[model samples]
Target: MEISKQYAERGYAVIKKLLNQDEIEKITIIVDLIYDRWLNENGDALIEHQLINMHSLTHPRYFKNNKSERIKFFELIAPEQLTDLIEKMFGKGINFHNTQLFFNPYTNTKTPYWHRDLQYSLIEDSIQAQEQNNILSLHIRIPLIAEKGIELVPGTHKRWDSELERNVRLELNGHINSEKLPGGILIELEPRDILIFNAQMIHRGNYGLNKVRKALDLCIGKQHHLLSGFLDRDILPNDDEIRCISNNQWYVLAKDIADQNFAKEIEN
Candidate 1:
């Protein structure tokens, strides 16, 4: 089957070697800078066990000054090939929904439970919002470090969980025991490999094995979908926040919705 068909059926597809070593190296530097800045600013509140944390670029201005490395990296290298594939999977135009850099640092070994992006309280109605011919959201995962990043139950995106599956999910609290469900598959990626999947898919990650597991999740959706607009509204940074990173025209649009939604609590 073709990549689009595979994604439509399985809810996920890994595109290998989508990036070269030089591109990966540059991204790694930017990721490290973001992580170090987070540590410096929030060391006291930082929880080592929660290794799958997200970060924002503080120097969007500097990065913007070097647009080829930042904005172009996302526009050309990251989503370029996936462009037609995405349109085929969802629709014609894709809107930037959310952006975040995931950090699974070394020595951290915790896994999140099996869950869908729709499970979040803020936008739990995602299923109802996704049209049969149009999807509300798609997640693009770019791995900067190699590891067993995410495991997903294939084809789970199209249906609600089975009674047994729901009960097990509730019991495990997202720490799904793959033994109980034999179909769960690990999504292992090499550096520069890309994985794009429906955000509604049943997935979990035990990131950061022996090495750090760094990835970027860029959520996008079909153009002009009301559901997409609803989800994006909750995640988009406010005008004041965007002003801080205005130099990078992309960062002005790309931002972590989780952080934006919980800005008050995160700051506190």
Candidate 2:
């Protein structure tokens, strides 16, 4: 299939049966090990943190320990056909920006609000800024387990408007009515299947009765160099200052009013 052309026109495409059982097992093992490690270190606190910061936690660069493992795993899979698909979408000379694992446990819970991946990045400055840099935000999701998958609004990526942005924020704040946004047209998949979409698309994590849905999510930027954004700089915090190292150059991080210390700073 001509995935690049399709993705260019439609903003998303699904590649069926990309991984064999053996490859799926390898990815499953790697993800399971990481999840175990996460539980060991943080216990239930990890889930609490996720619940408290679902929208912000989507930034993979902020996750350090998982970032290293993800980078290594991506390197192992870089030469595969998946990377070829990315090359077709973004052209040649592409490198890994960041990768993440989104595990939505199968339990009766509220569905995630519709939001764009670019909103979670440092590039969320202005509508004009988003238009200039939004194409760089490409996302690929590989379902590690079968049954549960994401729900997306097809062709929504191309409609660059302020209403979508406002809806995203309102949804995050639990103020928007679900019926107002696009709801159906879910992308369900079996194990090893992959779905690649533009990061600007309206999508939400859907967790049904399956109990646990694990997906290996990866993002690639336009530049060959690693991206320097809030996740790598502000949240991580280095040397008493938020710093981002890109192309071996250090840049000071921008202050975010949402930080935990923001309230304390105001009180003082």
Candidate 3:
């Protein structure tokens, strides 16, 4: 089946062997290092917050002055193999927003509950429902380990959530967010596979399916008013850093969009 067809019908799509073992190994090394650093620094906060994932894997702070590794990280994350895929699927002008590294919580090891990504944002729910198709928020999930990955509600990206979905996702009236929704699709993925899903679709991670979970998510999106300004400039390579790096299209586009959006703020 066509990737776009699967995406349109199911609000998600999976591509097989998108990264070879060697490629996966390089990414995992850095991811592992970053996770260790994060766990050391935020051990209490993460456990206290009960958060299972950490964002901004590219943030300079994580590299601990290891400029070479950080530069390598940026390049690896934007390989043409991935960028070309995104352009083909969603058309041009997509930009890197941030990154997320997912793992089971240290104490409870429970997966996050199902919910659409954007509802937690400041954008009103009514606007999100109205402009669902016009927006292009996506989570390009790349698992570093094989596992039963995520469960998503089909076609919910194009339509509002059902009442049952609303109750479960929002944990309304005693319904837990992790409560299983009817017809949810559990996408099993291997290390080399890629799962591209609508960020606004109802979904949750499947942490219990695997003992070790280290998935890297590239938060990519086309520039939209509703989603702009959330990007951090520090994640992009500096001018000197960008020159030596190959596969910088995503960062270039991200920096350009961030500049445009911030400029608009001053102008107004």
Best by TM-score: 3
lDDT of 3 by residue, 91-208 (tens): 8898889999987776654556998888788888789889998988999999998878678888898898788998998889899988889989888989989999999988888777
**Number of the candidate with higher lDDT, 2 or 3:** 3
Per-residue lDDT tens digits for candidate 2, residues 1-268, read 5877777667778889877787777667766675665566655665554531122222344355565544344333343667656666677544344456776643344556666665665554375244743455667777777755677776666766456546564454455624345444677778767888877677777666457777777665554111323223232323332222322111121222123235555698
Candidate 1 per-residue C-alpha lDDT over 43-160 given as tens digits, one digit per residue, 9 for 90 to 100:
6555644546653443353354554444433443333455555666666546566566766543444545677665653644434345423554677887877868787889877876
Q: Which whole-number lDDT from 0 to 100 does residue 234 have in model 3?
A: 82
Q: TM-scores, in order shown? A: 0.71, 0.68, 0.94
Residue 89 local lDDT, model 2: 68
lDDT of all the models against the reference?
Answer: 0.61, 0.55, 0.86
What are the runs in model 1 whose C-alpha is more than 4 Å off?
A: 48-51, 55-79, 105-109, 124-134, 172-180, 208-210, 223-268
Ranking by lDDT: 3, 1, 2
